[model samples]
Target: MAFGDIVQGSLQDFVNIDRFDTELCVFIHIPKTAGSSLSTELDRMRPPYHNIHRKYFYGDTVTFSRIEDEIAAVIDSGALADARSCSGHFSWTLAAPIRAARPDARAFTFLRDPVKRVISDYRYSRTPTHPTYKETIERFPTIESYIEAPETQDKMARFLMPGDVRTPHEIDTFISTNYAFVGLLEMYPLSFNILSLLLGHDRMPSEHKRKTENTVDNAVDETPRLRAMIAECNQRDTVLYDIVRHKLLTVRDDWRAMREQSRPAA
Candidate 1:
């Protein structure tokens, strides 16, 4: 719990004050993995522009036309505590552009079980206000038809590669290379602790440490076709999930033991 004198300033002064430094931390915010909550906490901890504007950028945009503009705006608006550190739900392709713009930036990301994530995404995609979900679903006779359709593939491709047109190999490469730290959502406290260490904080804010919402309960009755569609839709995520799970398992034995020790000595 000893956070050295790395940061020299009052916490209040740190918040909402823009100051750019040579070394920066880029939080790669993947959707639905407690991203919004974490971003809020980071915003409170850092300055306003320090948290990247996820809403402003169109997720479909392939070119980096607006990234430079946003960065410049952050610099001009004095909303960034450190111009080097930018956090948002951005594509991995932004790595080169970010580095070119700010060479000293380090990146981090959080991931979760792909099946659960996709189910949550589906639920969120459907809203009383937004008719896109209804329209998209209506276009297909069934979820299976939607999954097998070319449009689904196109959408998935675009989503997976937000800033660039990437092949499967390229996508994997981008993720592995760009991210400095990849925390698994299943290991909640450990993930937060790791992120805190990376951010040079003693502990994560208590407010940020809550259970996730929008989760799909296993009790929900899903048809075989629907299940198949869901699985197919999230196949790539499944691969990524397995990779992350394996990596975490490699280093989690000690953490597991510590957790067990902390439990009531029954």
Candidate 2:
């Protein structure tokens, strides 16, 4: 069966944020999916915010062991207890801990077309303005090499489904079950709708603007060969992307319906 077809319930059916004791918002950032823009907007909207990135936790080396302590310190300080929202590369790891401290915290994220996301990520990594530009160029001298690297394979699914999620079905179910919203990078307006719904606001902060990264040309030529190549490299990601796209549409429609229903004698 198709991945989207397998989902038996709507996203709202799985969401239960009203039951939380303390309110927190977590944005699980998947690279190259307009996550940076959303994070910036959320940082602007939500106060007492904590933003975590790989560099802050791991630096040039992996420090998986120290994550718990860092998370604990944030919890102990009661920063998370207050009205706070956090966005980070390590969002998935922080999700459970944040919820533990603040039972009402909601976690959400965005996904993009996997092929486009991979290409954007490669181009971004090579841009001089990017933090990891040196390391990326040193490691991946060419787009072909970058495409073949293990790091580029199903990166979104890998980050979102970090543990024992072995199949596309598991990934779909996990996201639907956990996240308050799964937004689309391409559908910014509708994605904003879902995000605003979760944020308990009618609109996002007016001061926040969409931040574009690595404005380099999109990495691929317009041709069947290039398109097929990118797709072949992202089979798993495509499945997850398709699922999110479908869910995002449903979520948006449902929200609109709710808003319409709640409207009084208009």
lDDT of each: 0.52, 0.67
> Model 1: per-residue lDDT, tens digit, 61-111?
312345546655665665443453567655556545665656666666777
Tell me how many clashing residue pairs each candidate has: 3, 1
Candidate 2 residue spans exceeding 4 A from truth: 1-22, 54-73, 94-96, 204-222, 251-266
Worst 10 residues of 1 by lDDT: 1-10
> How does each model score on TM-score?
0.62, 0.75
- The best candidate by lDDT is 2
lDDT of 2 by residue, 1-266 (tens): 11232134553442333222136777778888867667777776677778664333337742343455667777788776775788766547545676777776777778888877877778777775566566677788777778888878888877776657757788877776776667787877667654664555545334443344544432445466766787888788898888787766656666667657657795
In model 2, what lDDT does residue 66 have? 48
